[model samples]
Target: MARWQPKLGLVQETLLLTLHARALDAKLPSPILGDTLSAELAGAIDYDFGRLKVKPSLVATTALRARKLDDVVRAFVAVHPECVVLDLGCGLDPRMFRCDPPPNVGWYDIDFPEVVKLRSEHLPSRSHLIGADLTESGLLDDIPGDRPAVIIAEGLLPFMPGDSFRRMTRELAGHFPSGELALNGYTRFAAWAMKYHPTIKALGIKAAQGFDDPREPESWGAGLELVEEQFLTRAPEVALFPQPLRALTRLTARSTGLSRQGARILRYRF
Candidate 1:
């Protein structure tokens, strides 16, 4: 079988970097994510994984965020066993596989048509797959609104421009009668720094959208209320980090202001 040489947008290309990061994390002796599927998918893709320059810090944070998001979804599913899930801007993460929702739950992985096509080629069909541009107004029409949704936007927000992210949130909130939104929050400074990140730079991303205050999204008329702000720097998983990286994370964890610029998972109930 021929390897998949994906043709994706500049923003979509970032998925490859995250996918490679998870793949690398899986290779570790005591992997954080242990997403072996990512490792297998990375091997099947026809791309230069070396160019990603995925660092240990990147691997740690990426896996940690995914783990945190998965935890939220699992908890949500436990309560709302019949809930629907919207994995917006899902890329090729295969998070549905990691979450493993029961048969009654509806899991929809939303992404660009090409990215969805790529995922279909590699992963099995376990849930609903909606392949389209996220900006489409009626994209969620086929998704029933009666059931609660567990929306996970893992590595999504930054790529959305200006009010697009906010707009998307509003749409989702209105689309689903009730649900929770979980994502890796980025402060304005962190979003700006993302452009200079080697992996982001190589992917040619310019600027990204972010909020200094996690509660700011509540005012977007999305009906979303801040439930929790999990700072990964202070998370117990930091113990898994190697010497200097673990030490650095501990130092940053000392200050909430500093930790906000690091890895953060924001949970909002709508």
Candidate 2:
């Protein structure tokens, strides 16, 4: 059994941090995401997990975020059985396996070449792997435009850098005939705080993008409409969080302002 060692740059390396968080959650008595695939990948990767300093709260939030995104995928695929699913900045998350869409559905995972190479080394080739910077023009051209597309960004937003996020959204909205774009969003403060978040700080990650208003993207002129905003604090899954954190979440869940300071998922119709 050979362990696959990774050599990703700073931004790309954050994938492991997120991956390890889900792996940690899967080990719990009653996990939120129950992503055993991530757990197996974490064990096989020859990286120092301790250095990421992944805490229980991060694990809980990461899994919950993934669970929420998975729900979005399931719902979309149910409505549009012949739709396409795009998991951008996919890393080695095994979302295609988790979603397990019908044979008629097409799933594609996009990431940097290094990460995609690493994914091939560890996971089976289920989805089409596209290794190109999302900001590049004509990236989505290769994907079919005939079907509805469910685009998921996960933790890939802040890493988009500068105004690239704006351009990316417009491209996605125009590329798909119809569908939704879903991702874990950060408020202005939440995005700024990532600089010092324990796990993020440990990896020296600094995110530059954030929007306090979920509706702000609607103003991006991207032909996107706000479908729903799911703050993690108010999520039904928050009840599963550990001890003091769970109680604290219940307290803050009442306020969208406080909730936005934490984990929140945004979905939009195009």
Could you report the Cα RMSD, in angstroms, for every candidate shown? Answer: 1.0, 1.0
lDDT of 1: 0.90
lDDT of 2 by residue, 135-192 (tens): 7767886799889999999998878888888898898788889999999998878888
Give lDDT tens digits, candidate 1, residues 1-270. Answer: 458787878988999988998998899998888999988888889998788778899999999999999999999999999999999988888888898888999889999888888788878778788887876677887898999998999888888877888888899899888999999999999999998998888888899978889899889999999999999999998998877999999999999999999999999999
Model 1 C-alpha RMSD vs. true structure (Å) is 1.0
**What ranges in model 1 sit over 4 Å off?**
none
